[model samples]
Target chain A: MESMEADILIVGGGAAGFACALEAAERGATVLVLEKQPETGGSSAMSGGCLAFAGTEMQREQGIEDSAELLANDLKQLGGTDADPALIAAFATHQLETYDWLKAHGQVFSPALEASSGQSVPRVHTVDPADMVRLLAARCRTTGKVTLLVETAARRLQHDPAAHRVTGVLAEGRDGPIDIRARNGVVLASGGFSRNPDLVRQFAPDCEHAVFVGGAGNVGDGLRMAWALGADLRDMAQIKGTFGKHPTDELNNHSCLCVYKGAIAVNQDGRRFVDESLSYKLLGAACLRQPYGAAFQILDEPILRSGDNEVRILDFERRLEEGLFIQADTLEGLARQIEVPEEMLTKTVADYNAYVDSGEDREFGRKHLVHNHGALRRIETAPFYAYPSTAAVYGTYCGLRVDPAMHVIDVFGERIEGLLAAGEVVGGFHGNAYMTGSALGKALVFGRIAARTALGAAAG
Target chain B: MQVVVLLAGVVDPKWRLDRLGLRPGTELADESGLPRRLSPFDEAALETALKLRDADPAVRVTAVLPGDVGSDALLRGVAAFRPDRAFRFDTSGLAPWDPRAAVRLLGLAVGAACGCPDLVLMGREFGDCDDGVLPAALAEAQGWRFCGLAHAVAIADGRFVAHRIRGPREELLRLPPPALVSITNDRGNRLRHPLMKNVMLAKRGPVEVVTPQAGAIPRAVVARSLAVVPPPQRGAGACRILSGPVDAQVAELAAYLRARRQAAAP
Candidate 1:
């Protein structure tokens, strides 16, 4: 096999791989990023492009007070006891610095702050995810030390039995098979297995029938490669799907999260099924148990007007233009169009409005729009709207277990030498429930940490 | 029964082409960095062939793709379907923009790489270049019966019956062996997901690469240049958000909607 060498060899060129490469290259280390697809930007590019950060300029500019400590507390409270405290702490520690690093590297974020899923305050730093990946990839190229090889898929890790270290990777390139050696370390940033049906069925079997969306190249290559070496896995059973995906929507891949802005989700029976204030992932679980795994997001004119086109999940106008939402002058008409009982829907709306007026949700105990943010708004204005919704597995949030330093750990609680992982490939960040922007945030923060940890060890 | 399905993968529609141009001093459009996927039409054609094979154990389906090395992965994806035989022919210096020449070259590749196929299948548009002409032209050149925009195909009474939508109604046409049918995507012919085991096997297995028998064909059409341009915007008019009390706004909105509906009435 043909052979090549670099100071750092990274697999999968999504946000994590690119971030790792840029960090390593800037620190005077030569890096090689292997992207299996013809193009870069894996699932990170396919995401809604929201990044979770605390105490940023955007948050302050929007007059929203947020801090790393509050962010950490909210994550713990939302994720519950299952989340690894160390990883959560690491994210909270480096989130602000990573945000600044991204900005300094030409990443642009919209000035709007959104509170979704697990946030006490609005801190979702949104950007064009595909543009961010392209920007980072370009920065890596300008360093003159990182070689991004597209259409090159890493087949297996080359391990040294005596040293007990992962030396490099055996990959299949466009021309033929090649063996690449990493002098410092090998980082697995191959993202999640959202597109791999078998892996999805094996882990998140409950979400098997849910719609699948994400990068075409995300087939759990890194997870399988690390697992072959007996790496411990975490949060595999906690894989959850995002609610509000239209079952037949071919134009848009992202979900429409109207519930986060004060819309109620109702089942075919025209009755509220779950508290809309819960994270969309939890809502997705509840939705799947309903008849036909389907629900409708009921919103009013004011809620529809609250959509921000800059945010992917909140871009309700675009979804409306695509004819994904049913608009009716009256609630009865909406019920007729969606084939639900008019009386039950009317009663449901009346009850919800009463809860909104009384400042208490008697059923499901919902107070905020999402998590602990946004005041509840009564959906009384017309014309009303109903968005047909289903759950979609955006990314598998469970994978090989790793320390906060990003070193792959064995099932026996030993760190595998010279092996590191980041991004969706390494789990333990989100335990029981998913935060809206944390996946991309974890990719950026942990990716930089992995690079620093690897280079620091090499220097020592 | 033997069938040959022509698979011409298109550049993934999801990708925003930041830069696209013709290769210097050549008519070939440079698509070096763009991602490609099996288009709906290609999937429809392949699935129709697979459905036929599923109904009859005697049927042998072979998938043939004509492209350079970049399309090898696409061939492997096709191979995951476990066709009787799947292969890719060299299209190093050929451009499919010239429909007449493409038909001749494709005919040669099919005849040489895959044996004489009892029935030929392809999408309405061959690759991203052809605009629904190559299949019919190829069939005419080979002197075989032709059907276009077929949604599904089946065997009945030792002949192929093709179903297609034409204008307002669905049309069913029957033809004997040695025929060509161009397929259009439909719910009935949606491509089935490949098994993970077969996907892994195809990844490890060696892909059969065939060198097409080259012969000069006179070109009737040639692409001089190509450039990526933004699609024309169809103005639906700007959105007007209403302002006032909830009751007044609803009344005004109702009036506007009623007026618009009246204007739309025949």
Candidate 2:
């Protein structure tokens, strides 16, 4: 029953928690960060590290004309009709500052802007997100005011019912149970509930069948804590769905074989369902339209030999040997192995071959009409690969309801005193669908906001 | 051409003896305070060292363990890999400093023990701290070229060529003499387990135990050492097998793949 004390207790040492700790410590407050995992990066470290921001110093210097309004509108449109206007506005306004802060922290960014999911403009900025976390960690270590407790999981929040203030947290570390008392406030920067099947089923039932591609540590601890404290939840139906033929055996490894280049995906009924030319996110959603949200990517020998054969082909072959991929010599045989209907699979490939001969995908309107008549070689090629594609849930968009100031609110819309949330733990930021750089951007922006708001409340 | 691997034994808190339903007394505890297996990354390092040594008879492999006598079992486990030599240094009363201090001390000790070997290989990051800065720090302390997260390594022209995952892309870099490498378990590289013969040989081999030097004390001190507790076990959902018409499924998968690629693309 050891006890520790800090001015602010930030839970989850991912991008958001670290960002909040950095801001609070830099503002002259004693902060303590608790990470459930041994590493501080969380899923942020394993990500592609793309940061989306409009009108950044880099972008502005390059004469890329953009504004918060434009970005906000784009996000809202991209998220469809269900997006929250207030959250979008807040995220857009603060996104530039997030980018600027990262740049100031020595995060190297590529000057080249690329397109991301749901963005009309090429506003996606790429950087090593792990490096960014490392930089923040290094800074946090030097801050002197910030104490990091890794391999510590915050289980519950201690609240003063009379004052309606969250005074501390209950956590378990290597030693044992620890009571962390926070004088200022508590910030929950823990990530989404993708790994929690129950929560996923409750929130995103359509995507409950998706496989997880990220860390094993994302079990919705933050969301559960907030829910226990009567935090109002929103956008419970949203998810960041990943569409890839992820091998169940190599779930922990990042060994993804790009089947898009040379293979055609088929459903259980042996037919193409959606336009293969659409984005991967849309394709992931389309997979959910199937029976179990699963499909298989079929590839031939010629497609495997194409491109950087050593880099791409050998990597896939290695995975195949590791039993991460399912291979068969014939279309019927491949379907039988994965339990798909053999007769239907044969007919489906024949139809796809016919379409390939005509250089047209009438049903889905695929645009990459490179007449690879050779690619249409009957699925009779030896060692035909069939990677079962499943929905891998990266993160849930559902989280605690928050105001523009990033303060968590109760079900009745009353702000929870001394309790704040940021990152994927806060809802309405992403709406129905997620954009690529939005997670990192939202973490940085709302993390700073939560710290500032907590500081203000503490001062009062 | 002997490859000397500095195998530091770390406690694996995840591995439990299934038959006994308990852990052996000699097992090292992980941050969760549970009996765990050996560090997977360190095992990978040992595997790489052994592979390099086996590739050429001239290459000899040695293992080093820096801890108290309590770490003998762990050292024995590493020695089972049939290293040319194994040494256990006295780690008593040493203050746990930052990686910089640990690397400095270990580099000096290793230099003295092996007289500056051709190349030094270790895990990119230990599970305990996982800062991934130790090997680089050690290399910097010894004024040697260093590479982190090396997925593949090949020796050419008496220099080590390493393929590393740097950010998004993989880079092939060549380091000249006296290089230090921190190996990361990437997707392709797999570590092999020791055979029965190697294990028996390791059991019979002599493990040289060295006491601490006179007036030896670590320059750094651990402010506090905290145990890491394992989180509650999560319930895995039932596997839902997708079954239906093949054409419809392919159509559905294609759309999903395209959208995901579009989302992930730079």
Candidate 3:
């Protein structure tokens, strides 16, 4: 076995791992990032690239009123009693600085902000997810203090029993077994277990039929490794699929959230089920309960024209070009195309339009487009469209329990010294429902915090 | 029966190649740091070989890949399929653009990595650099019978049979031992996922490395320069929707169709 040493050993080279490495290197600490896949960016690259941040210059420049308090309050309101308030507070505290840190380190965000899920207002700052990871990885390499080894998978954590601390990691490199010692600590940021069917079945059996799409390397490596050491898990039962993925589209991993852009979701019976203004996570559960576990987002030319190509979920025209959206000149034609009753669909459209005019939704009581943002619009434009949608488990959004500093907590609620975690691997952040962009947001926030805590512990 | 599969992984097609250029002072394309996976054709060839092994317990399969350190992961991925032997031959200082030289080196690597085999398999294009020519060129140079675009391979009457499609027609060609088949991707030959246990074992196991003796072979062709060009833009016209009652819209659409037909009539 070949042995090496670094100040901090970060597992999984996605957003969290790269963020940790970049932060550690900037602080003059030697970091080694091990990525199991051939590529560095894991599920973070495949993500929709929205980061939820509050009180940022981008939001202020757009004249959108937002603050960290509002962001935290919204998270708790959506999360209900299951959310960990400490973790939410930690996120709200560091989110602004992290946003500045990313922008200072060359992370580019689009000018447009989208309102989805739990946002009180539009706060999603978007970037090309792959480019963001690549940028961080490149910066890490340039620091001369971070060594990133792709194709090296961390197999087991080396623990010092006498010291009660994690000392190193046993990894399998391209050549053979490699024993790498971390002088400071080890950060587990290996993403979620959506790709692991057995784990998904055990945790979320109802989500078995949901399409599994994420980083191919995410097979619960971090969660399982941490579980071996008696790490207490959090929010595992709250694992719900995200709505709006085209179940049969294999070429593209992105999901079209037409509902967020003023489209109404209709079941196979051509009737609206849910309010369509709730969190997509809640909508996902409702969608799964529908016939064939599928629904169609019905919209019009005006709603379709409101899409922004820069945002992956709102890229309606691109999906149109891919032939994923069914378009017709009339509701009757759309009803025939999507195989719904013409009279029911026409009546449904008429009813929805009447609700928009009367300022009241009698059926589902949908008052806004998505979450409390964007007024409801009448779906009466000339060209009508239908996007076939189903739920997809993009991330498990649940994993091991960790403190605000990202230290792994054991079943007994004691800190597992020198064992830290971040990213999707650390749960308790999103609680019962996920707000759009918060998963990626918490990954970046917690990753930098994990690095700081590790180095800060060593200094103390 | 001894079967050898020549696998050359390609850069993942899903990734956009922002930059493509030759390495400094070398004719080879600078592809370091780019992610690669087994191409569809390569997967078909390996799956075909696996199918043959599954049918006969006595059949021994060897998977050989020619690449640099970056390709080791691809070989490990093949090893997860649990072939009798899987190894990578050092492809440094070799130019894949030079077909004759590439064939010569590939032939030598195949011979050195695995002994004389009853059958050999490779992808249609061999690698991203070739234009569906290296497999046939190798067959011609080695005096072995060759079949191109084979979707599946099986033994029929003690001879290797290649199932392929040629010009929209399916054809099955039977060849004697020591024949080479260039496999093409198809639903029938889609690669199966390896067991997680086997994948873990393969990751931990040491990879077998082979360095083929690249003798001074004269190159018949030389690449002067290469340029990466973006694909042509496809401009889609805005959609025009015909509204109002059905009959009037149908009549207007029929008239437009008739005008187009008249304009197209020569």
Task: Pick the lDDT winner.
Answer: 1
> In candidate 2, residue A383 scores what lDDT?
66
- Evaluated at residue A54, the lDDT of candidate 3 is 97
Q: Which digits, one per residue and each the tens of the lDDT, describe model 2 over residues A132-220?
A: 88788888878899888877999999999898778889999989999999988899989887777787777667775566656567888
CA error at residue A303 for candidate 1, angstroms: 0.6
Per-residue lDDT, model 1, residue A142, is 94
- Give the least accurate 10-residue stretch of model 2 chain B, judged by summed lDDT: B21-30
Taking all chains together, each candidate's TM-score versus the true structure is 0.66, 0.55, 0.65
lDDT of model 2, residue B107: 74
Task: Provide the global lDDT of candidate 2 against the true structure.
Answer: 0.71
Interface DockQ per candidate:
0.02, 0.02, 0.02
The local lDDT score (0 to 100) that residue B139 gets in candidate 1 is: 96
Model 3 / residue B253 / CA error / Å: 54
Candidate 1 colliding pairs: none
Encode model 2's per-residue lDDT on B1-266: one tens digit a residue. Answer: 64667666665544552332112232222223333345767777777787677566677777777766666766776776567887787665453345655775577557656786887888887545447777887888789888888977778888888888778998998988688888887554555444323444566667778775755544553434334466676667534344443334657778878998999999
Task: Assess each prediction's global lDDT (C-alpha) against the native.
Answer: 0.89, 0.71, 0.88
lDDT of 3 by residue, B1-266 (tens): 98989998988778877778877787777777787788888988998999898788788999999888888887888898899999998887667877888888788877975567789999898878889999999989988899999998999888999998889899999999889999998877877555333554688899988886556456887776778677676667545678743435778899989998999999
